[model samples]
Target: MDRKIFRLAIPNIISNITVPLIGLANIGIAGHLDSAKYIGAMSLGVTIFNMIYWNFSFLRMSTSGFTSQALGARNLTEATSVLLRSVIVSVSLGVLIILLQYPIGQFAFRFILSGEEIKGYVEAYFRICVWGAPAVLTMYAFNGWFLGMQNAKTPMFIAIFNNILNIGLNFTFVFGLGMDIEGIALGTLLSQIITLAVTVTVWSLKYGRLKKYLRYADLWNKVALRSFFKVNADVFVRTFLLTIVTGFFTFASSSMGDTLLAVNALLMEFFMLFSYFMDGFAYAGEALTGKFVGAGDRKNLKAMIRRLFFWGFLVNLVAVIAYSFFPGELISLLTDKAEVIRVAKSYTFWTVLIPITGFAAFLWDGVFIGATLSKEMRNTMIFASMMFFACYFIAVPLLGNNGLWLSFILYLGMRAFVQTVIARKRLKLI
Candidate 1:
């Protein structure tokens, strides 16, 4: 069991770690620029994409859960059906996002971001990056399907390749070619497209045989389609609420001031770093739990859950220790700006609580997702989001940024606590 968990977790951890490295590279590039506004602009741009892409993350989650279940049940046809269905939905939605990019960009700038100078840089970034929606979304589908098929190494390979290409491109465009924020955006867009092409080529070479099982009829079978949409819709709503919390966090930070925005943005990277680590294990949970559930092996399901939590606890411990002891050293890696780094130090303590409060939420999310417990997952997010706002409203007045951190911590803790309780009740039935 431990071996299986680590098999998936390690590659995922390597792949997932590269994810934040991309963000870090973007931030680090912007951080070294002359003004703090560059950092703020890049952060806002990233946040906007987060709001857009995070909602569609359902593509990956649902596909992984369904594919893993189908594979576990030895239903290759259903598994093949899952991939085709997800890719179609993802590509369609991606096109929709492109058609609607103007309005989305406008709404984001007008409502989500503040500060005039930063808006231009952000707009330039958004316009270029939005075009990658189709590629990004399509990749989401493939990555999910690959994980579900119990092929973490493929995604890891794709991710590593994408990261190296992206970082190199960003540097060449930004520093080598002397472009501004647009360079970073272009780098990302090109990387996404290339990665998508790589994903397709790899899938064709490795898993093309599965296409023999694909049936046009099964792709749209009313019952199967219903289940697919039902799970995805629930996940969509849950993910939407999640984006709200995170988006609002960025929005609120921007409202505080550019210095604070830069500080908070840099600080959040710590949370992101921690999350990628936890999510690696979570992915393992998702793959294993779905496999067990589909096989109706309740015993392994329970054992997997137990071991997942144990691993989650150890990851959290390492994160807390690292964040507590070396916050400054870590923050410095993102930016050399003295003021931003100085301001960020004041908030370093908050990150120490992140993994501690958030690890269970991450692990349970994977378990529930694998079991296809979308409703429960959605309900927990809804409740936690509500509490987050309530805490922010009540606490921010007294504590300011500290209040925001407090609310955020409570939000994480609440999600974990609620999900733990619900899992206890729900897993028994499964």
Candidate 2:
């Protein structure tokens, strides 16, 4: 079990690490620009895209769970069908997002307050990056499918290539050509398309045999489709609430002022950094749990869960230590702006606490995802989100930014607490 956990986790951890590095690259580039407005605009723009992509994360989560189960059962046809269904849903949703881009942009701006100075840059970033919707969502399905098949290395390679390409392109476009936010957007858009192409190519070479099972009639299998939507609907609601909380975080910071918003954005990179690292272990739990469930291997399932929790704790312990000790050195990587860095230092404690507060939630998310227990996941998310808003309302009035950080911390802790209680009651070791 230990070997299996590390086998799946280590590659995923490396791959996931790159995701935060990409964010760091974007922030670093924007930070070097003449003003912090570029960073703020990029954050707003990315949030809008996150709203769209993360909301549809069901494509990845559901597909991984379903496919892993099929593989565990040695049902290649069913695994292929799962991927096909996810692709169909993702492509359709992506197209819808493109069509509704204007309305989506309008809705996003309602939550963002960069004033006129930064608003134009935000809009430009959104318009240009929105074109990657199909590629972005489709890659979600592909990435999920790959993980489900226990092929983390492929996704890792693809992710590394994608991020490196994006950073290189951004540097060239922004600095070499002297462009602005649009240059960053263009780099991201182009990289996504290229990554999607690579994903398809890799699938063709490695798992092309599975295509034999891609019958269109099977694509609409009533039983399978019902299960798919039932799980995905719960995830959809959960992700939507998550988006709301995150978007509100940015909105709240923006309400304070542009410099504060920029400070918060840089700080968010810490959260993102922690999440991506933890998600590697979480992904392992998902893959292993689903396989065990599919095979009805109760003994191994119980063992894997224990191992996952153990490693999860160790990983977060390391993260907390790093965040606590090297706060200044870490945040400095994102920007040289002394003021933004100063404000960020004040909030560094929140980042230090996040890994410890949130690691369980991240781990259990994978557990439930692997078990296809979407209702449990969604219910816990709803409860945590409610607690978040309540804490924010109560604390922000008294503590100001400190209150906001408190609310966010409480939200993470609540997720871990609520989900653990629920999982303990529902999950049967036998």
The lDDT of each candidate is 0.94, 0.91
Please give the distance, in angstroms, between residue 25's alpha carbon in candidate 1 and its true position after superposition. 0.8
The residue pairs in collision within model 2 are none
TM-score of each: 0.99, 0.98
Name the weakest run of 10 consecutive residues (lDDT summed) in model 2.
421-430
Cα lDDT of model 1 by residue, 129-201, tens digit: 9999999999989999999988899999999999999999999999999998999999999999999998999
Model 2 per-residue lDDT tens digits across residues 158-254: 9999999999999999999999888999999999999999999989999998787777787788999999999999999999999889889988988
The lowest-lDDT stretch of 10 consecutive residues in candidate 1 is: 110-119
Candidate 1: residue 418 Cα off by (Å): 0.4
Q: Give the TM-score of candidate 2.
A: 0.98
Model 1: lDDT to the true structure = 0.94
Backbone clash count for every predicted candidate, in the order shown: 0, 0
